[model samples]
Target: MLRSFSYLTDHTGFCGTIKNSPSDFVVTEIEVTEHSLRDTQAKSLQKPMEVLLGQSSPGLCAQSCDGGGTPVPADQGLRWAGDSCPASPCQNQHESKAELKPGLEDASVLDSLLGKAVSELLNKYACDLKDVWKSKSDANAGTREFSLGPILDKKNRADLHSAIRQKFPFLVTVTKDNEMIVKGNADYRELCQFVTEKETSDFFKFLDAKLENSTFSFEPDGDKEHRKVVHHFINRKFGKLLETKSFTVTDVNDQQNMSIMVRFREKGWSRKRPAGGFQEKQDLYTAFTLQKENLETLEAISFLAAELGVLPSDFSYTGIKDKKAITYQPMVVKKVTPERLKEIGNKMEKKGIRIHNIHSACQHLRLGQLKGNHFDVVVRDLKHHSHDSSADLKKRISEAMENVETKGFVNYYGPQRFGQGQNVQTDQIGLALLNEEMVKAVKLFFTPEDTDDPVNNAKRYFLQTEDAKGALVMLPEFKVRERMLLRALNRYGVNHEGCTKGWLSIPHSMRIFYVHAYCSKIWNEAASYRLSIYGSKVVEGDLVFSEETDETISLNDKVHVVTAAEESAKKYSINQVVLPMVGHSIKYPGNKVGQWYHERLSKDELQTCKFRVSPLQLNIPGCYRPILKNVQNLSYFLEGSEKGIEIEDNYLNESKVSLHISFDLDPSCYATVCLREIMKCDF
Candidate 1:
């Protein structure tokens, strides 16, 4: 109900903070290692982690802080040892001791050597560091429990304190101890708005108990429900959790690179060839990483198949990686000979498609079968700079990273998920389709934006005049979807009844995307609203998913009361809050959340039951999304980088940084959403 941060102090340790710009935020993917069935389940059951592959620069892993505040130059710090240290899964540690020299001990003499400006800078920010330290201590030692909450699974745990700069910039503390969050089973107590101080005094008293694995449980610290009646508040904020920071990301497609390796998912793939290479059996699989320059997977495969005299179907990929960015993903060729594949790979590389690790396997790949994607990204050319000093930049970055790392960032869908032109507008037209607004859907499809393409501009005149047939005539031959809609309208009239039929004429996949997008919009909106109202708290009548493979709970498994559920949910990370994805056969959550869903639909004049139109078989049963996203192996570092560009603008500058970041997310999680919280800017 309230956040009280008065308890933290410099006397106790904390994770320090630093800031980063999108100068060179490099994200490299860490492909999950293949495992046996037992290993797979064991890994799945392990607690989730928010650790990412983190290093401030391409090189330069900093050493852990020993609590006393002071700057350790790159030459002296263990983190900067780079190759000598285990940067990957860095143990932010004081593994090495500083051999203090004379004169440096005197702050003034050292300041003079570093320059008066640098000296003044340290004086300006030293107190700020203490405050940051105190705030962390408070968050760690008081109101908020010290547990990492699936965030501490990072291998860098013990040494994070040493790596965090305790002086200016990175002021966050790094402590090795953890406090258990208040769970239902803790010295747990519920405090409602109606309670009097006397009735709730006992609950507040437990705040002083030994917090670490105390194994202490007690009764509701209240003696009675006070006479005053208060309403139970539910989270109802309406927006994504991403902050609003602005930085430019260039060199995006500069080197759209991707290197992928695949493990065959089929069994009995050991067939060998007479020439020492594995013999290509019909069921044999060949796993490889397809690295192509400026070519989509399909395009790359198509070109290769043409040259090799094989159908593209000979190559089966688990999923498609981004065509624009340098991506790496595993792929397999079913029943393919290694020799022939090698020949194709050789020819393919000459054509800009470089295939790596084309080896035979016993199994084939299934969609979403691999562990997770690894990202190596570089955020470049930050336009805005409040200050040019490295100290200032690091300080800002430290603060942001500390906040994001600790509290976690908001999870939201980025703009790329939405299609161009009226196809998908945060699921607007899709919602219209679900609502059965035939005329609305058709009109929206024809609605041209200000930056209309030439094709769209050509059709705009006819569409604006309500001449559907004329618009169809203006559509180019390549406008397959558009022509289909026009043909339907030409046959049927131009009314809602006619347009509904026209809407049905579009490809089923395309139409379903629209519907799904709309559903996503609903989810985003609902999630935002709930976070605002409840601030990530559990409430009465919520439904929590039991497993990744399990679908949403049926109506029969609903929670009808609040009682101790809040404490239980908070303890187990089972907030039970979920939103419907706007589909038929989808049973929405119960109580306030469900009511809120209905309210949202009523405002949009839509309903889940309305997703039953057969025109395009858009009748998809919906899914549910948890309000929070689990992040694994979160780590980051920022350093001064030379890869920058200057622009003549109000905020554009030439300063650049290579903020190295690495993490693994579930298959459906959006990396953009996570980065948004850090950059707080448009990608």
Candidate 2:
């Protein structure tokens, strides 16, 4: 799937050892709460001490208010509503529960509850985080926040909690009835005690003591089903043990869960690939128990970015990861010292986080965040309906590709999606498009259009009679014009308008020439696509390379028809030499002349062709050029001129292909356009 090349200059490779290997640094202080879980059960009398003052307790911090026995002014009440009091406040103390006002049940409250639940639900979490701080003599481990979404709807919160308890009772406590009371013996004191328990305290204290070693570790139960137990410990301990630090731990396999049976191989650690993988592995850095999230990947990057001293720009990822799918992505950070990396890892472990391993990477790793992610997705629950079959799905995909262009679907580098954890603006995409277009336009002029204008001393040639009569002028093929264009490109810089703005001779070199030619090709291709879409005939239309010469007679007077082969030849001749001929080739006097002769004689050579700038050109600069094959486009069209075949057809016909793929990913990433190469699909 990935390859590397070693060249003479150095041990080189293409898509080499994935740069920016995913860095698993321990972050402290970054805590994320699962938004939805089962309703919490109140701490029983015996569990009271453990519930309060415990790292994994229902983090209920209370503030006493003058419990005015009489209904205080509604304005002075704690903003909760209930059945006993119409549109009332003071936390709705009816004997049942506090019902939030219609839109007043803030997301933050749910978030808080979820955070509290995350601690209470997982015993290891409670032990590592709670005990650390309760036992102040022990140093704190770091903290890390993780994210879980689709916060439970208030109605479902209870059921979800129950399910959670059934699955992970040690992690959470489920209640059968509401226990919030604002009056009498059932007041704030009970609530306060319910949250700060000795169990939670001891948990945090344990992590704190563990942190003294500074090395982190994940001791997952190799059994896949029990992985969640490991992650539970990691998250809770990290949150409670470390006074200030954040970390993220992710599994490196499908189910991209946060759980792991990861144990530090202190004795077996070596700089060689692990049993199943092929990387220069290293010693397991830290160790601790872990639990899985039963979802997609763990977004360690976001957590690290927010908690550690990592800048948004400091990270690049390969895939637009799935938050629910347990997946691991290569990570990298620049401008940071090893000490810093170690410090971060240590801080994380001190709080109950375990760093499975840490080894130096030669290059930075990115999660394919650029150019968007590549995906192969498979859909389930597909019905074989006579009306809605796989064929229909394929048809829908094909149809969508032809009709509309999605706006928000930007042509930006993938990292743009996480714009500093902000939103991407239309203006940025627009600028990127514009810049690409201009670059392409420049390249186009360098190759095909460069020779349009004559060298003042050169004999300006023309095919005299231009009266639109079936007149064909195959004078010297398309290469002559292409050379001229290449020459012109060498001499002048082409602007967006396709006009020369400045001049440069072969004195400089080919790099500039390449840049110029590449840009122009992009611009022309964009234009050509637009023209084809608008019902224009580029197939047989007047393909002109010009400083318009007055034809002895106007061609408009008659219709001109030319062979497709001639058109192909001309297009090839003009663009072929633009990119490859410059600098040293320029130094050779007859190099251009030789190229001109070679292209004119070779009727079989295929070349890329395009017109001036178009919108799409703004994204991918460069016109279609002569190449062995355009694999990306071949699935739909007859690839190159496979022998000299001629067709008198008036229009290009549509051809379709069937495509099916399956994808497994972390959340927050989509497969909208990943299948473009196979079949264009957009909605």
Candidate 3:
């Protein structure tokens, strides 16, 4: 059962709009593909397009390559067999110091494909670019040519197409198997080679038209991954579509398909760490679409990285995703071969994790490197109002959606935002931390709940009573971090330094996360207050953010404050302004807003000004985020409609109507807010 939250349905006023189920909500991320800078510009730039084209015809493209070329991603021909190489490539993949072949940087390859010795052509454009053109076989007479520099650096689209096509040919010739036959005269063949083997076949569709026709013409294929392009709605969508499901139904299925998906496309590199021999430093990047629902990003990556003889810390990713949903993200490991990565991925498939689209990256991924996330949530078992007719239900949904689109709603943190809600919330612990109540914070972390498990309750009770020895003994092996804290207490007593060490023992990411949740709680309450008073219109000096700039705000950048004029100039431009995520460097929205933060901090006994700066310090460089989210592509339909729906076979209750709704939201924004506005029910 999802933990319930106060004000969850306050906006929508329909608390139990739809029966809540884990299977009902599905979130799929739209990944940003990063390309290597050293590779041919055409190869790097075509990644996203390559991914989309591969998905265009699942039947046609599935059999084709990933990211064009041979489809093993980047150069798959980095061989391990050689005089210098060990006999077994599989056993010594990490030790194999196979240098990336010259083909990737073979600018001369483009000469044959582009039909021009790039040295002369580049020199014609600008004599200064002489050094940019590499001459593999130059006589040094200054008359030689080979290829172009950082291909996309200054080259325009026309130049790229020209470079892509050494020469434009009249006919697209295909073999009996429908593979396009490469010919010197046909530069279109060269361009087609840049596309997937499946997509290359499509070029022949117009070949019949081109052979008999006067001019070349064909409709552009639809990019497989079509973006909604509108925006996310964190405020009004969530909490409304749900009715708190009872925990009694033990057999209910919350299948972790992650079909709605932890796929990250990290674009950076790490130092190579080989298993046996000195490793060749190569830029290793692999974008994986993980069908893993039960595994954390770190957990799955750690397992695979270990296979490559690297630590989980060696892998870099944009963000971690929910363990219960299907996800795709990019992961970067330096110097790891695609073959080894693929082999481990294939191995993982047996354990319910399917990894795909292994590729190379030029840049390493840091946290928060994302555009946003797309969600396809299904709300089941609509508890219909007795008097409401079918038309009325539809009208209600439409009007609710329209109102949200017009005025927008409060972007409160959802129940799941803090935690499962069964235990004392993280935000509450964060509040304790803010107040310098380390003991209280640690105690909350081990809150004794009246749970089905006695050992857990006993462990919590021992920790609660300061029986550190008992707590340690009672704590199960699964409570690894907690055991460390209890052991510290047992050894050092409840002194300040001991408590600090105990807290510090937790992972750095997690330690900061508690504070983040606290900040989120503060922001949510503050946002709710603003919504109650100001509605959607801008008040004088009220903070606002433009749609375009909001996404750029990071934990590192100073919080953006909207001016009164910026708020008025472009209508919707300054709609959903941000609030600070309370940190040492944060400047509160002065006036009542700023005062509100101080007041809340005071209530928690927290000193507002006290924050640490070191990585170990809790004084984080918190960024600003929109108080309200703008939702896009808002759509809903009855589960019994043309859109597929199913009856609950596991539940003991009668089957009710299912409402399937789909929308997109920004990264980190909760979709529950939109449902809250739609249902108008108190959750």
Q: How accurate locally, in lDDT, is each candidate?
A: 0.45, 0.27, 0.47
Point out the worst 10-residue segment of candidate 3 by lDDT. 226-235
Q: Residue by residue across 388-439, what tens digits does model 3's lDDT show?
A: 4343344455566677766555556665557653478878877766666777
Which of 2 and 3 is ahead in lDDT? 3
Report the lDDT of model 2 for residue 532: 32
Candidate 3: segments with Cα more than 4 A from true spot = 1-21, 34-287, 294-315, 323-364, 367-369, 384-391, 405-409, 454-458, 461-494, 546-576, 613-615, 641-655
Q: Name the TM-score of candidate 2.
A: 0.22
The parts of candidate 1 lying over 4 Å away from their true place are 1-324, 329-370, 383-391, 420-426, 449-455, 458-507, 547-577, 586-591, 639-654, 681-683
Residue 423 of model 2, lDDT score: 30
TM-score per candidate, in order? 0.48, 0.22, 0.54
Give the per-residue lDDT of model 2 (tens digit) for 467-550. Answer: 111111222222232333344433443443332221122211211323333333332232333233322222333322211111
Q: Which number leads on TM-score?
A: 3
Regions of candidate 2 where Cα sits further than 4 Å from its true position: 1-302, 316-328, 335-357, 362-376, 380-566, 569-671, 674-681
Residue 660, candidate 2: Cα error in Å is 7.4
